[model samples]
Target chain A: MAVSDEQARDELGERLRKFVGRPAAVAGAGKDPVNAPMIRHWCEALGDTHPAYTGPDAIAPPTMLQVWTMGGLSGHPGRTGAYEELLGLLDAAGCTAVVATDCEQEYPRPLRPGDEVTFDTVIEEVSGRKTTRLGTGYFITTRTEVRVAGEPAGVHRFRVLKYAPAPHRPHEPRQQRRGPELHEPRRHQEPESRRRQEPAPSKPLRPRPVINRDNAGFWQGVAERRLLIQRCTACGTLRHPWLPGCNACGGLGWDTVEASGEGTVYSYVVVHHPPAPGFDPPYAVALVELAEGVRMVGNVVGVPYDEVRIGLPVRAGFRRVDEELTLPVFQALSSVTAVER
Target chain B: MRAGERLEPLEIPVTRTLIVAGAIASRDYQDVHHDPELARRKGAPDVFMNILTTNGLVGRYVTDHFGPKAVLRKVAIRLGAPNYPGDTMVLTGTVEEVDGDTAVVRVVGANGLGDHVTGTVTVTVPGANPEATP
Candidate 1:
């Protein structure tokens, strides 16, 4: 068998960028006109109760621009042959696995109920062959323009990495001796100190919070060692994280309410791989439903990641990891000792 | 505005809570954004940031600059590198063109690794830039 030529691979990488700027989807209309059911499902799934998405003056969330353009289970109408060919080319080059990496949206006007939506997507840019943790691949970016009744309403930029899956590394005998997942969750106990023992991280720190006008107040409450959720002044609805307007009533008036710090883990994931800087791998992160009836995501401490289960009782606590950063975390309370609340 | 006007950079600190909260807010259930062990198996060095969080941040960056009234017509951004927790990302923008209330601006968000997000945004600010007035 002959080894593949490296130069030929480089040429394939160059060929991808040429497809940029070509229209990938042309004049595709959404199957369903924008309506209440879809909007309700979306907000419910995200746990967003902002009042703007309901009632007579309802507007869809701006972050949902791509949702309106989704082809759904049936698939999209405007997908062109060229887009297929582009994927085929990459597949032939051994880049078959794909994962959505990021997306961007710009809204000129909010989408309203009963609006008929149409959109077109262009193959905006294709990157050079780049190596990522998953494998070597190119980044394909598509720009979509969404229109409501022939008027431009929003634009969405979506990108994905289509890569050849990374080869699995043979495990050390010690690692092989243990069960795949059971041994991992314990390592999160001493994250920062353990990080000091590992080799230097090749990547930068993880992305941070984007504090702005709508959400800055929430962070300030965290700094002051309090858990705050937004409460609608008009309808008495309590919301978590925070939003500019109430989705329940479309009320602009809101005030902050302190939480009781006790909650239950609604769902959780015991992360096992991808050890990171300053954090021990195999940690558990949970979506906790606060006593206030709003959910927030945070790390679950005081137990092995594997011990964190759905419905586990937890209490909020502040962990000042460093002088610059303090996070709101939850400590898993032992279920064996306490009676059900 | 001509091509050279720059928007002030916003400095943001990445925290574990930020990464997890942003992921949930966007309805992304991917473990890589919240769980370290799963992320390791997927080949990430640590639980890394997700693209949705970056998209939301970029949207906030533009709106924060244009004030509350400005409307974004288009935001086309590309992700370059992974943003891990414990790092800072600085977002900055420059106006590229202005025509009749619509202005095109180039935005770049740089973290410790390199550029995290780079894109162009088209926005309409009713009465801000002199050149945008017809």
Candidate 2:
């Protein structure tokens, strides 16, 4: 006699319970010691210029805690059979698809260059079978304790759902599979009647800047075709993308200084996919370091996206994208122009 | 930091290079973050940003406002809309509470689809008090 589905679920839940508190990984070591190269790569990729993440006494970005613990493409040597066995059971039970749900991390101490990293993970919990938008599945959570030279540094809690695909409607197209099950469907779907009443526009306007009180003056400057950098009244320090208080001296009083429009491409990335409104694909967005010693983000004009490079001299210019929008852009200066400068 | 104080918004263009670069940099070799064809097979319209990269971006947004002296103590986030390449994610923050040197900031990153990430970050900024300044 075949067991009832409810009985099968209960049996599976019981087996899953035993897996909890079991070691997922034992004494896993980082593939590489925390070093400048990896930190630099992370910084460049994220466009993070925090001085704390660099220099002789640099501490790794706190968010980098998990990066050091990842097993990478080759996988980690310390992973135990119990974790795999648990996953195999779930797969055999028809919960094959997986999606990371959420993560929680705490950094007790900062990671620094040359720190030897090691970690151990344990299966913290496995939830009972449940139904979600994706399908019926279980949520498996693991907690990892990361250390530097035998001292506690951080803790990471990662959770993922192993679910079988939800049943599709018979008439629905099979190729019309949904995006990542983790993300919600678009929030601004138009009503079918309204959408039919007025056809959608051909091109989308550029996303408007969120002009709040702190940055309103900067946008005002842009309207006047001036790139303004904030100057601290007390410390005379210059800051870009204006903030409420001075970071250098924590001063509240500040004024604006018009940029000289001279800068260099500190870093850049070429956008290629998913297609935003009002812009063509394969364009360069650069972090331009102004001569005033502050970096600002803008589009790189007068050059192909691929040609934009670090340290390339550029001049700031304003582009009126629409009636109410004027943006600061950078014009890459040719070698001849750089020589003239 | 005072409660209800808002941080300036930061706009980040989601680019394919950023997606691939961030995945590799964070040691997350997920194919959906790089291989578009594979991503399509997995039902994603195109390659999308990984959660690690989103976490890094959120961390940077907070630190950039608090300056180099600031340190992040905790960051807990939940993903929503996918950050596909060629889109934009605008990160906004509000200081929800403050005690001594540590402040809890509520950060929301919204893309074309909607809120991509919503979470709170605990950051400690040395000498963050504006009133104490002369």
Best candidate (score: DockQ): 2
For model 1, give the interface RMSD.
11.7
Q: Calculate DockQ per candidate and list them.
A: 0.10, 0.21
* Segments of candidate 2 deviating more than 4 angstroms: A1-10, A167-341, B130-134
Give the 10-residue window scoring lowest on summed lDDT in candidate 2 chain A: A187-196
TM per model? Answer: 0.48, 0.63
The TM-score obtained for chain B of candidate 1 when compared with the true chain B: 0.92
Report, for every candidate in turn, its global Cα lDDT versus the true structure: 0.68, 0.78
Clashes of each: 23, 0
TM-score of only chain B in every candidate structure: 0.92, 0.95
**What is the CA-based DockQ of model 2?**
0.21
For the predicted complex of model 1, DockQ is 0.10
RMSD per model, one decimal: 23.1, 26.8
How high is the lDDT of residue A235 in model 1? 99
Ten residues in a row with the worst lDDT in model 1 chain A? A181-190
